[model samples]
Target: MTEMEWEGEFDPMSDPEEQRHLLSVLDSFRSYRRLAHFNGTHVRRQAFYSLPQEHWTLLSKPPFSVLDSFSKLDDLIDCNAELAEAIFKAGFRAFLAPTLDSDWVASVVPKKYADDDFRTYSIIMDNMKVQTSQNDMEKARSCINQFYREWSAEGAVERSKCFEPVLVALQHEFDMRKEADPGLDRSAVHVLAPGAGLGRLVFDICRAGFSVEGNEISYHELMASSLILNHTENVGQFKIAPFALSCSNHLSRTDQFQEFQIPDVHPSSELADAIGSKVPAHERMSMATGDFCVLYSQHEHKHEFDAVATVFFIDTAPNVIRYIETVRNCLKPDGIWINLGPLLWHHISRKEDDEREDKSRGRRDVVDAGISDPGSVELTNNEVIALVEHLGFVIITQKFNAFESGYMSNPRSMLQSSYRPAFWIARRKPSSS
Candidate 1:
């Protein structure tokens, strides 16, 4: 999932209030251009990487709340220019307030984290502002790299990774869906994660009783993901070789990479002996390597699996259409689709309507250009739904947590996303039903 795609799978909710929240998100988030804002107080250091602004506003939407605590900053800032400062400020206050007193803000900040939470939060904050003077698009890349570095240094290899928070959200949604409909063929459900990073989510998917297949562009991420899967009881390792290491430096967590310095046998006799003692063979982990988009034949195996999913992926794809279509092609006619992520289209086009339209400004351009480029491809709320419907998927439930301040600790966190918390669960359009 690239800039135009919605990769992360969202947990489903059947509550009318939740559904209303989803629709509200769709309505409010339609135009996110204004959402990409700078902290004027930081002057040259604008963007999410700059200094925090307690007086700043996260967005113009609903769920307004001040980010007074660090726990609130993640929910506060969207992936925008103003995120860094908000998180840093909120985190500093959250974990070290008593020490700072009135003189704290005036003194040079300490290098070490007071605790793990503050460390994670601080890393996220410091990394966000690493950009010296690059455009927003480039800052996105820079900040992402910075965030990963700090996250990994804090021992994200096995914990506190984006994988866990995203997966926890995914698991919650998955369980809710299962409870809502027990007839979806619980056994042997297949999972597809196109850009499966470290593969933690894949592990979770497999652990949830669904067989998972992943397509990562790099050998490094694939290897890291593979190591995790291999050691796990029920999972699989699928990749296209040479885990993309160029992007490795951008990612801060390297503990897993350090562990899997050598790729081992997939379900090898050695691995078998290691795992057979615990998990059964039938549920043993599996892995593959290849372009996931090329799995047309795998998709042709009709009724072979129940569903396909992506996480924090679709929104990053350069071609959102191809991404969605790819998932559609893989899923059984009656399978379900889920995603979780901020609708990041506004950063691309600064226009909500672009998201629904066949807007293809070029995904690579996003990586090259800064986040402020107006020529990006983004869709409006109506467009996202239309696009999903066009893909022949029926939305069964949706939830919008765009307004939830628990997401970040920024002034924007106080502002509501027009459609953040924009989560939806859908089923393939049954031909007869």
Candidate 2:
């Protein structure tokens, strides 16, 4: 185990290598701190379930308190080998098994790329350190801002089961509408996938025979997704090395280098062949980069889409009501909106009185003048659902589920993170005739 030490400050103008090292080291220390917090928080939550066959060997045959005979020389010098082994096995079962499970999710790096793995691993591993200094919030901000986009893109899954609800609901709606009017044009069905990262979901929707446009706000993701969608030949086969920590639950050591394939939109030729359509996938699909709330206000896009789909995106906005209103404007009457994501809001908040003042007067002025404002406070899931209904959206289908979802999550940690995602399908109410 690496000795715990204090974090040191670094010059902002340092070389890229040094800067990378500084950030990685600080992140390692942060991870250690987060793990410590997790342990402390979960100490009392015991799992009463039966252990699997592998862990059966760890239980003691009989229990006896060694401290009862502490005065005896043998008792003081005794080595309880079985107890030590049991503890080690339990730690391994929780923290180490997940890394192996990760390998099953995606292919591992080949032997030829072993050098590449070690090269990347060395860079991250060499910087691990015990942080003893006072917390630095600015450093945390810098690290997250620099790497979060890349991490998100690399972690996208090939076919996320989380998307099943949206797909199934959409297909049912499409079939129902078609049956009602047999002459309806299938090719004219359009979908708007906002906050789409790397265009995987959009691509899949297009494959299902809908004209899809993906909208993203982050330039980092836009650039990376574009590279995968338009430029790469075998786009879905793209891969990257993500983690650098070793399997021993120690930041000081390095895990064996492994690469995982990142999910991307299918190549244009393949999609065209599968869809049997004259329009290619590139033509059937497009990406627009901008704040989604303002995207349609300038273009001839109002009430244009047949449906809107958002996965892991509604929570990105500070005020989700704005998103709901935007969806109302972007969809035709009775147009569907399918959303799947946790309601955990990511934006920071301000005093309610100040928010009202800005809304009553200066908010529009600030936006028109391109002056940025602090994001709106997050709303609970129930609040957002009620807001959608108040905005004239009739809820069609609503389902709730809890599961783990994310890219590049550390496989060594058994602290598998999960969220309660709300799968909602709603439609815009037609105007009163």
- Per-residue lDDT for 1-433 in model 1, tens only? 0011112122112333322332222212111112322221122223433435543456212343322221222222233223233323332332234333344333434445445543443343343332222233332223323323222322244233334444454455456666878654333445666666655455455444555666564222432343333332222221111111121232221211221112122333333344212343234334444334434324363444455556556666554665566667667776777766556642454334333221322123223222222343577546776888877888876666633322211111223323234556677887611
Q: Cα lDDT of model 1 overall? A: 0.40
After the best TM-score superposition of candidate 2, give how far the Cα of residue 61 lies from its true spot, in angstroms.
36
Cα-based lDDT at residue 29, candidate 2: 31
Q: What value does the lDDT take at residue 375 in candidate 1?
A: 42
lDDT of each: 0.40, 0.51
As a whole number from 0 to 100, the lDDT of residue 337 in candidate 2 is 93
Model 1, stretches more than 4 Å misplaced? 1-187, 227-284, 296-304, 345-377, 402-421
Q: Best-fitting candidate, measured by TM-score?
A: 2
